[model samples]
Target: MVVKSEFEKLGLPTISVELGEVELEKEITENQKETLLKNLQDLGFDLLDDKKSKTIEKIKNLIVDLVHHKNSELKINLSDYLASNLNQDYNTLSNLFSEIENTTIEKYFISQKIEKVKELLIYNELSLSEIADLLNYSNVAHLSNQFKKITGFTPTSFKQSKDKTRIQIENL
Candidate 1:
């Protein structure tokens, strides 16, 4: 069984969850690694090299954790965090992410944040002020502004439209 903690060294901050054991004594072969890599590539991420793939995976994990976990308070300033955590200059990391992902890291970060806001809106647990605080926005107004900018509708409008259409996570 592969312990969840085994992924700790990958360096994306994650809460320890009680993942049940799933035993597989067989070691992953080179071909299996290639196949896994191919699957990830098919999902829109281009795996350039093992080192790049690892770095990209770390970024993906952080983004997903930020969006999917309500209790997760992600450091909103991703550039500074990425620079320090990945041990690279912000410019370098941003450039590589933009080059390979064909989108700026800031755009990706904002997209993830907006997705999270959508999820919160769906849950109807937190008020706009609370959601803004949770997401580390300057204020509810700021959150609404950004949310409206990325998505055509205002937060309130988005909430109203929820019954009509729910946005899917993968589409974001």
Candidate 2:
């Protein structure tokens, strides 16, 4: 929405837009591109133009969609899901992600899932088993184990404690 408004402000047509990306219907001049990039950077966004940078951004976006938006049982393994969505080999994608982000893709995916779990827990709308099932965890024990591993507290303790701060999704 910001991108659309910003582009309209610049008299450009926003063809498509999503988190961390935007597509213009027509090519803009270099000066316009610089101005847009600067404006977006001021608003805490980046214009990912290079191939590798765009790939990395796509990976993050897909993971976010899977973790936060889908909210249902996964029909396939994450590796296959990513591979199919990206139309690339899983090993290649994993290597590129690790190289750029300094973390494994699996770890990134887990962190995203854990963040979503925290969100659901904070909302107080779902049981632990439901949360686990929604997030594709095999069982509540597995979910609790991972929650403890990443957050240093079980789900119940996390809910009951007075200080239940969660890491920002961007940080994860």
Best by TM-score: 2
Assess each prediction's global lDDT (C-alpha) against the native.
Answer: 0.67, 0.86
Candidate 2's C-alpha runs over 4 A off are none
Q: What is the TM-score of each candidate against the true structure?
A: 0.67, 0.93
Model 1, runs deviating above 4 Å: 1-49, 67-76, 162-172
Clashes of each: 0, 0
lDDT of 1 by residue, 70-123 (tens): 334564467776777668888987777777788887788788888888888988
Compute the lDDT of residue 9 as modeled in candidate 1.
Answer: 29
Clashing pairs in 2: none
Which structure among the candidates has the greatest lDDT?
Answer: 2
Which ten residues in a row are the worst by lDDT in model 2?
A: 67-76
